[model samples]
Every structure is written in structure tokens, then in C-alpha cells.
Target: MPHSLLWSLVLAVHIISIALWIGGIFYAVAILRPSLGLLDATQRTSIMLQTMSRFFKGLTHAIPTALISGWLLILHEGGFANAPWTVNAMQAFGIIMAGLFARLYFGPFQKVRRAIRPQASAFDSIRTQMLIIMALGFLAILSACLSHPFV
Candidate 1:
């Protein structure tokens, strides 16, 4: 395949993975979370765990796809030194987002998964971490759009 075509394909995958990650966070934080208050504590906890589990499973795949494709796209564009400032900013945000995810997953998320009955504080911690990750993701998207005028 032509280099340009391969770059385009990788870019498409990167964008799609970003969409899934950010879109899932948007849905969970903005929509589902608010509605979750309608349920009783036990039911709410169960539903929240199940919903987050599904989303996180997708993340296990989507995050790596985004990172790998993004690196490939960067390499195709002549490496980090040749990339625009916005691209570098996006990469920095992406790395931060990934680190936040790792912390959330190993910390509050694991606690929630293991507890016989998860506490409100545990859930709150997860929500807080997710909010930070989502904010970084949005910033990364903005940087990407700024880097590429056509976006």
C-alpha cells in the first residue's frame, strides 16, 4: 500500500478509537450516571459495576488501538521532532489520560469489583478519575483539530 493510504487508514483507526473512548465517557458521565440516581443503592451499584465493566473492556482494546495507530501516524509524518506543537500536546494529553486510566482501573475500579458491597466513596473516586480522564481526552481532541486545520 502507498504510504499516504496507510497513514490515512491508521488515522481513521485512531479517530474511531478516540470516538469510542471519549464517547463512552460522555455517555457514562453525562447521561447514565445522572440517571443512575433513580435506582436504589444495591441496584445502582450493580448496574454501575456492570456498565463500567463493559466500557472498560472496550477500553482494553480501544486504548491500545488508539496509542499504536497514533504512534504509527506520527512516525509516518516524520517522527515527534517533525510534528506540530498541537500534535505534541495531544500526545502529552493522551499519555496523561492513559496513566489516569491505569490508576483508576487498579485502584477504585478493582476495589469496586472485589467488594461484596461497594461503598459510595469507592464509586465517587472512580467517577472523579473518569472525569479527569474525560477532560484530558477532550483537550486532546481539541489539540488534534487545531493541529489539522481541516479537522
Candidate 2:
């Protein structure tokens, strides 16, 4: 395949994966959480757990896709040695975001998943982690936009 075509495809995947992961978090935190409060405690917990299960499952795939595609995009531009400062910064931020997500998944998320009834505290922890990840994601996006050769 032509390099340009390959780069375009990879970039598209990277963007889509990012949108899915970040957009899901935004929807859950900004919309679903508040709306869910209308339900009774038991119903709320059940629904929230089910919703989060699906979201996290999707994230497990999306995060890796974003990371790998971003890495490939970076290589296509040039390896780390030759990449611009913005690319390097974006990569560092991406790594931090991924690490934060991993921690959230294994820590608070695991607790939430294992509970006979998901606890409010567990959800709170997940929310906190999500906020951090979202911030990092935004910063990474900014870095990408500023560093992009065509920008």
C-alpha cells in the first residue's frame, strides 16, 4: 500500500479510537451519572454496573487501538529520535493516560466489578480516575494538533 494511504488509515483509526474512549467517558460522567440518580439505589447500582461493564469492555479494545495506531503514526512520521517535540510530548502524555487507565481498570474498576453490589465509593474512585484521564487526553489532542505537519 502507498505510505500516504497507510498513514491516512492509521490516523483515522487513531482519531476514531480516541473519540470512542474519551467520548464514552464524557457521556458517562456528564450525562449518564446525573440521569441515573433518578432511579432508586438498587436499580441505579444495577444499571450503572451494567453500563460500565459495556463501556469498559469497549475501552479495553479502544485504548490499545489508539495507542498502537498513534505509535505507528509516529513511526510513519519518523521514529522518536527524529520526531518533533510536540510528538514526543504527545506520546508521553498518551503513555501517562494509558497508565492512569490501567490503574483505574485494575484498582477501582476491579472493585466495582467484583462487588455483589457496586459501591458508591468505588464509582467515585472511577470517576476521579476518569477525570484525570480525560484531562490528559485533551492535552494529548492539543499536542497533536499543534505538532501536526499540516496544521
Candidate 3:
């Protein structure tokens, strides 16, 4: 394939992956969490733990794709310093997101996954992390929306 087509494919995958990841988080945090409060703590925690496990299983691809595609886009366009505000903002957002992913991948996410028995502490931790991740993800989305790459 031509270079432009190749880049387009990468970009397409990257954008879709981000949409899924960020959109899922928004839905969970903005919609699901509040609704979940109706249930008792045990049920809520159990369900959230299981739900997050599944969600992360599906979302495992999003971060990696974003990283790879963003890198390629950067190299193709040159580097962060040379890119427009939109690209630069996206790169910054991506870095923040990468850090969040690392924490999720290496930290509480593991413990939460292990809590198949619905531990409240585990659930609380997972909820807190999800909030943080959701906030950062929303910021990234907002940045992307507001930024004008050509400007």
C-alpha cells in the first residue's frame, strides 16, 4: 500500500480504538456508576469488578494502538515540537493516558481482578482508579475536540 494509505489505516484504527476506550469509560463512569449505587455494596463491587475485567479485556487493544499510531503519526509529521497545537495536545494527552494505563496494567487492576469474591476495599480502589482514568480520558477527548491540527 502507499504510505498515505498505510498511515490512514493506522490512524483509523487508532481513532476507533480511542473512541471505544474513552467512550466506554465515559459510559461506565457517567452512567453506570451512579446507577450501580442502588445495589448493596457487595453486589455493586462484585458486578463492577467483573464488569471492569471484561471491559479491560476488550479495551486492552486501545492504549497500545493509540501509542503505536500516535508515534507513527508523529514520525510521519515529524515530532511533537514541530506538530500543531492539536497534535501536541494529543501527544500530551496520550502521555497522560499511557501513565494511567501503566497504573491500571501494573497496579490495582490486578488486585481488583483477583477479587472475584467481591471485596469492598478492592471495589473502592477500582472505582477510585476508574474515576481518575475517566477524568483523564475525558480531558484527552476534550483536547482532541478543541484542538485544530492545522491551526
List the candidate 2 regions with Cα displacement exceeding 4 Å.
149-151
Show the colliding residue pairs in model 2.
Answer: none
lDDT digits (tens) for residues 7-65 of candidate 3? 89987988898888788877877788789999988778776777777888777777888
Each model's lDDT: 0.91, 0.87, 0.76
Model with the higher lDDT, candidate 1 or 2: 1
Q: Estimate each model's TM-score.
A: 0.95, 0.93, 0.79
The digit string of per-residue lDDT tens for model 2 on 1-151 reads 9978888999999999999988888898889999998999898888888898899889899999999998898777778689888888888988898898889888888888898887788888888889888888889889989986782
lDDT of 2: 0.87
Candidate 3, pairs of clashing residues: none
What TM-score does candidate 1 reach?
0.95
Best by TM-score: 1
The model with the greater TM-score, 2 or 3, is 2
The runs of at least 3 residues in candidate 3 whose Cα sits more than 4 Å from the true structure, single-residue gaps closed, are: 40-42, 149-151
> How are the candidates ranked when ordered by TM-score, highest leading?
1, 2, 3
Residue 37 of model 2 has an lDDT of 89
Q: Which parts of model 1 are misplaced by more than 4 Å?
A: none
Q: By descending lDDT, how would the candidates be arranged?
A: 1, 2, 3
